[model samples]
Target: MRPGQRGARGRRAAVTERNPGREVSAAKALQKVRGQIRLHLLSHRTSVTASGTLHLKEGDVPYTATSRHQGTASVAIKHIPQELVKRKLLMINGDVHDVPVEVVLILKATGGPESAGSSAAMYLLDWYDLDQELILVLERPVPCVDLRQYLKEKGGSLQEHEAKIMMQQLVEAAIELHSKQVFHRDIKLENIIVETGPDVPRARVADFSCGCFARKGHYHLFSGTPKCAPPEWYMHARYKARPTTVWQLGVVLYGMLDGHPSFDTLRFLRNKLPINSELSQNCQELLQMCLSKVPKQRPTLEQLQHHPWLQ
Candidate 1:
């Protein structure tokens, strides 16, 4: 109830983001908390804004039946606002979460891959039946730093030898997940984790809260961040699920070496998209195959690894 910076375990804890209602440290030392970002929901407070627009996102489930939220991106708003909040706030099996539980589970389940063994991710706690609340234990990576910062500081492009090393590290990790039949639908600078150890920078893909498992024969349609997404993942925008890891892999490769994608535009599929710089022939060719109109045309993870560009 009191608003002031308090000490945690005798160390000073700043009122960092949003103030917490209370901070009681238990045995494990996990902080019982409040949200950093408070959303205006239809929970005994707020008004209706809009309705009737459908949206698509990565993974099997969606934020809503309409109003597309693509890729690893977190949506701050949706078309059917109150309806969605009511479901999240009230808690019901049929209740729809802004972020689908399956997505989070899929991410959590990938503690490790064919080789990763166990990358860090949050653990899910049960929901309260009455209000549809979710409890998650934050499991930060052992040595946490994403590629986004490094990419930005470097100002695009990697040296030949360095690129090769990064490519191999991420590729092997990716192959490990694919072997387990997992598609880390969202792969980008924001998700790759660099451990602070002697190990060769093993990349642990994060944001599985947007990942969907591709069953042996059950294909589900969805969308990803178009900038980095394969055409099959973007064009259909509602097409049945297919193998998109290959596509995303290519995009990330482009991003790593170039700082951005071959396409410099933001939200390529969205309106008001600006003119993007031309991509190099090698990069364009790779993106072309990855962004092929058809899903079946894209190369497999192993095949992409062996491509001439990689060589």
Candidate 2:
């Protein structure tokens, strides 16, 4: 069965069996709560910055400027939310310690609870609502660049071994996001930052503008990049979260190996786009499995973690 078809049918059956009025009321309540959350966040315009912990430094430069998004850097601070500090979410040189706060300011475009602690993902240290513009205070890893720029500086592609190291970390990050019920709808080179200070580059997933809370059921709306969307979305107009995530991982891997723009979904579906044959057998297999036209054929995040190429 196509993805979400079963769920759609089941929902239809339940609609016929349950009280329609109650369902409508429940949906309204959910929307009301979401609205309240937004209002609360917007009302706290200066609470974060006023706390004296986070300082917006002068002479801020564009940290990561892509056609899609941009971020600015600021000075380091000593204080952060106690919850984040307790969780030891921030890492400096691969160690969990009380370190100074280096922040990047990204214009917030999405609404959700703060991101959960994951070293593989950038930490949302603080946020401010300024005159209807929401700005996110994100952790800034010193001496790092976005993966897209990194790839460009490295001659457009990474070697298989180097790619493996980064890919493994990315896969683990995806798993952690899902486990925390956060669905990072867009996972691509531009949204990932590569920390060059480390011996082996560490990948930190960033930019959650297209993200939402992970939930069971089909997401009818598609907010991610069109070129990177899964085939299932084009064919059925609906997609499940996990399958879509796996497909994006494949897209990232393909770009890393091919040293080209991500394959157009339509071209790939038409079979005009092919995986590079020069890649090793294990790498090719992993790519093939991830880019499978059938969503069910793709390996789960856990399976990807244990894939031979990554191992």
Per residue, candidate 2 scores C-alpha lDDT tens digits across 1-311 of 12211111013212222477755654454345434444433343222221112111223221322221125553222223222211112232343332112221121122233533335566654432222223345666777888889999999999999899889988988887676556777788888888898788888888654565566688877766777889988899888889899999999988888888656788988888888899999999999999999989999999999999999
Supply the global lDDT for candidate 2. Answer: 0.63
Every model: Cα RMSD to truth? 12.8, 18.0
Pairs of residues clashing in candidate 2: none
Error of 1 at 171 (Å): 2.6
What TM-score would candidate 1 get against the native?
0.53
In TM-score terms, candidate 2 sits at 0.65
